[model samples]
Target chain A: MIEILKQGWHTTIQDLGRLGSQSFGVPISGAMDLNAFQWANKLLNNNSSAACLEMTSKGPELKFHEPSFIAFTGAIMQAFLNSKPVKMYKPIEVKKGDVLKFSSVTLGCRTYMAILGGFQSEKVLGCRSQYKGVTLEDRIVKENLLLFNRNAFTQKGARVKTKTTDYKDVNLKVYQGPEYHLLNSHSQNEFKTKQFTISPSNNRMGYRLNEKILQQLPEIWTAPTLPGTVQLTPDGTLIILMRDAQVTGGYSRILQLSDNALNLLAQKSTKDVIKFELITL
Target chain B: MNNKLPFTFFRMHPKVILLEWEQDPSTETLKELTHFKANILKYSMGVSQITLGYCSLLVQWKEDIINYSDAKKNLIALYSNLSINSTPAKTKHWTLPVCYEGEFALDLAHLSSELKLSKDTIIELHSKTIYTVYFIGFLPGFLYLDGLDSKLFFPRKKNPRLVIPKGAVAIGGKQTGIYPNESPGGWHIIGNTPISLFNTKNETPCFAKSGDTLSFYAVDEAEYQKIQCVNNPKAYLTKVK
Candidate 1:
């Protein structure tokens, strides 16, 4: 068992997410960066869908009740074990009563921490990803106790390194959306030329862009939406739906990020400048 | 039924295929969509999730296991042979009780004045018709109900409210629905229901699904509170058809 001493900005237990539930209006709430999430599990030799703690901006201070093997990945969150600095992208052994604390985030917007086996959380609708309506609690709070297998075998801890990219500025590749043709020629050109910054009002639901393209189009019927879908509002705001976005929407879907782009964009913070690049399959 | 399938298929993602029908929302098109969805689910292989919308369906599969070209070909062939006249699967019916008094019905009086109808007349018109559950979206258990009385049609608010209370029966444009949870919305609230539309503990979280029928009946505050205390699902849900 691990007890949270101080909760971070937005900490939640997430797995690969709840699949086969979008038809019922459930959002696929999971780790923002799939690449990093996979790496955390891979380092610990855990299952790909093992539930891990996802921390945003910063991470919680946790005290382990029993000895355990843990790994940290995604967005260097200046983590330390018992006041000693720990390296990212590698598994570390923690003894009982050891406290792990994460300070200011030096890079990336989210981080993932994986245990040897996985965290044991109540599964709602075939997944353990924490969403408000589906899960008992939306996010981790102070004094929350997370239970895990205490007797799970840990592999020999190895110091491994992986190449990390700087997500400060990125070019997100996207495919044309269903309503891409609705935009006039000039507006389409502007969409590709203008660099949009991530607005401060970003969340797991979506990332609202700072720039707006005032192009008018006929209202469309509410249609199916997914993560990485870029919707254009009437006010011209370009919102990129993220992992926890709704299954359907009414706005014009103008662009959809590629899977690689979605993973890269998840590491970006507010005010990060990004340009949309159109790609053909 | 239309003999020609009026759908345009495209790849939304590497592993996601979207089939969008050109027809507008109508009973005929909805039924056709329902048939198509059922057939696709029955025939398709390696499908991970299938989501239905107002006029489209998104089929997602595992990219590593299913080739996009092969899946697209199979789906197109399946669509061509789909029979719309076949009987659909059984649909559930739910009769919900709503209270339209005091704080629950924030816009009932305003809507009554704007539509030039008495509050009682508005309530009577809304409760008389049976609504079809189009698709659940936007929020969990948030049913996009169809069959609103044309007389009750009202435009959505220009400025959306920051927080609309849960179970607030609302109207916007030509549609009526009940908010399953408290969130920001632009719909005009006319009533509130005490029964929870969504419960995570249940095997299926949503009470009603697509193609289900729902009818709202007017209830006083006393009755609403009485029904709220009943936790049994079998007690509240009754099949009319």
Candidate 2:
């Protein structure tokens, strides 16, 4: 068991996410950065679907109750165990009552921490990822206890240097969505030329990009949408649906990000400039 | 039935394939979608999911696609050749209860005055028609039901409510639906249902499927209370033969 001394912002227990339920209108509320989440699990030799704690901006301060292996990934945050400095991307051992603390950093927007056996959070609709309506609580609150297999951590794994994701890169590769042709010719060209900044109105659901794509085209009949779908609203706001995005939408789906691009975009904070590099399927 | 399987396919993502129809939302489009979905699920090699929509289907494959054209070609061929529709044409019809009295009818009076219809008449029109569940979105179990009477068709609120209570049944443009859970909604609330539309404990969270048909029946405040306390609201759900 891990006891949370201080809760992190938008902290939630997430795995790869809930799939096969989108047919019933459930959002795939998974980790924002899949590469990092999967890497953290890989470092601990845990199952890929093992639940990990995902936090945005600030991370949590927790007290470990048993000897276990853990890993931190995504953001290059300054983390400490018993006030001793710990490095990211490396699996570290923690004894009973060892306090782990994380300091806020501006380098990345989201972070993932994986335990030895994975978090045993409540699973709903075949996922451990927390969301409103589906789960009893949406976030990991302060003083809450997280369940995990005590003392099940194996031998310390070799430190892995990150390679899958480039956090600093803002150029996200995208594909033309189902309704991409709906955009006027001039507006369609704007994606290649214009650099969109992440707006303040961003969350787990979506990232509302700065600047209007166009005076929105007519609404399409409600269609199935996915994470990384860039929707154009009536007012012309270009919002990129994230992992927590709804399954269906009525807005014009103008562009779609590849799974890798979506993971890259997750690291960006508000006001970060990004360019859409259109790629042929 | 859509002859020759009228659909335009697209490689939307590395793992996602989109099959879209040109027509507007209709029972015919739904029938075709339902038929194709059932077949795709049966023949899934790595197809993870096939999500339903008004006029399209988003098919997601578990593995990344090495050849988009080949996958699209195969799906097109599969739909065109499968003529024997194993899926039953007749859909399950349900009659759900709603209470339009007091606070449950948040926008009833305003909608009545705006549409130039009495409150009772408005309720009559809403409850009379059987609505098609085009898809569920916005919130979990929030059905995107079509078939609102032209008379009750009103635009969504200019300013959406901060919090719309769960079970709030409302109309927004040509659509009418019940909110399965509490959410911030812009639709005009005409009534509320005490019976839960979604429960996580059940194997199937929402009883209403995409192809299913449903209608609302007005219930009194007393009856709403009696039905609200029960653990399983499915017991109260009436099946229309």
Query: Where is model 1 chain B poorest over a 10-residue stretch in terms of lDDT?
Result: B231-240
Q: Which residue runs does candidate 1 get wrong by more than 4 Å?
A: A158-163, B1-3, B64-67, B84-86, B231-241
Off by over 4 Å in 2: A158-161, B231-233
After the best TM-score superposition of candidate 2, give how far the Cα of residue A175 lies from its true spot, in angstroms.
0.8
TM-score for candidate 1, residues paired by index: 0.96
lDDT string, candidate 1, B8-82, tens digits: 877777778888989788766676677778887787777788888888898887663346677777877877777
Q: Write the per-residue lDDT of candidate 2 for residues A122-190, one digit (tens) a residue.
A: 889999999999988899987579999984656655566667566789899999998899788899889
Model 2 error, position A98 (Å): 1.2
| TM-scores vs. true structure, each candidate | 0.96, 0.97
